[model samples]
Target: MKLSEGVEAAIHCATLLAQLEEGRTMPASALAEYHGLSPSYLLKHLKTLTAARILESVSGPHGGYRLARSADAITLLDVVLAIEGPQPAFRCAEIRQRGPGALEPEVYAAPCNINAAMLRAEQAYRAELRKTRLSDVISDYLGEADPRALAFSCAFVARNQRPQG
Candidate 1:
């Protein structure tokens, strides 16, 4: 299933926000700059995340976005759903029922095997995402990232993050 680029941006932004100190926030522009994404495009996903309570939007000068709850409390699934909506990636059109030599509706009472299989796969995919918390992602990244890259991230966060009053 093809997902939107927004999903990657939102998750990465959320993970980056996890690096912020409590009571601090990172602006959408900063997040876009870090990932080389368009602020306008990233802001749309950020707004959706805020609406989903995965992230909070603070207003005024020195205002920006922060996780609404702890990173451990937010799963990748939450961010994904917030950006992509709760709809399954594969929508079953039941094309099998519309082709020539199609049987009566009663004959197809049971779901199409292909649709059921795809749905099952999607369920497994979502379950895996649900198992992954933002904290886990950040921790894993920190453990394996190159030193220079880590230092750069730390420096950027220090420079761009704002303190909330």
Candidate 2:
């Protein structure tokens, strides 16, 4: 199943936020600039995270946003739900009884096997996402990324970030 664009933006944003030290924050505009995104568009997804309690929002000159909890406490599934809502990706339209040669009520009364299979796949996908924490993803990425580049990125973030107050 395909995830929404908001889901992708939210994941990357969370990963950046996950890199910050405890009690630190980055403004939405700063984050948008860092990723070469539009602040207005990115802020919409940021609000989704805030509404989901994955991140917290602050206002003022030095105000911004920070994780509500540790990175290890948040999972990809949490972000997915926050952006995509609780609807299943594969929606079954119950086509079994709508064809020219339609089946009887009893023949299609039981849950459709195709629908059940899709639901099962969705469950497995969610289970995998739940098993993965945001910190785990960051650690894995840092492990494979260029050390010098990673250092430079961290330095950039450190320079622009604000300490939580």
What is each predicted model's overall lDDT from 0 to 1?
0.92, 0.89
Candidate 1 has which clashing residue pairs, if any? none
lDDT of each residue in 46-78, candidate 2, tens digit only: 998999999999887768988888889999999
Give Cα distance to truth, residue 60, candidate 2, Å. 1.4
lDDT of 1 by residue, 1-165 (tens): 888999899889998888899899999999999999999988989999999999999999989999999998999999889988999998889888887988899998987899889999999999999999999999999999999999999999999999876
Residue 160 displacement (Å), model 1:
0.6
Q: Model 2: clashing residue pairs?
A: none
Model 2, residue 124: C-alpha shift (Å)? 0.6
Q: Assess candidate 1 and give its TM-score to the true structure.
A: 0.96
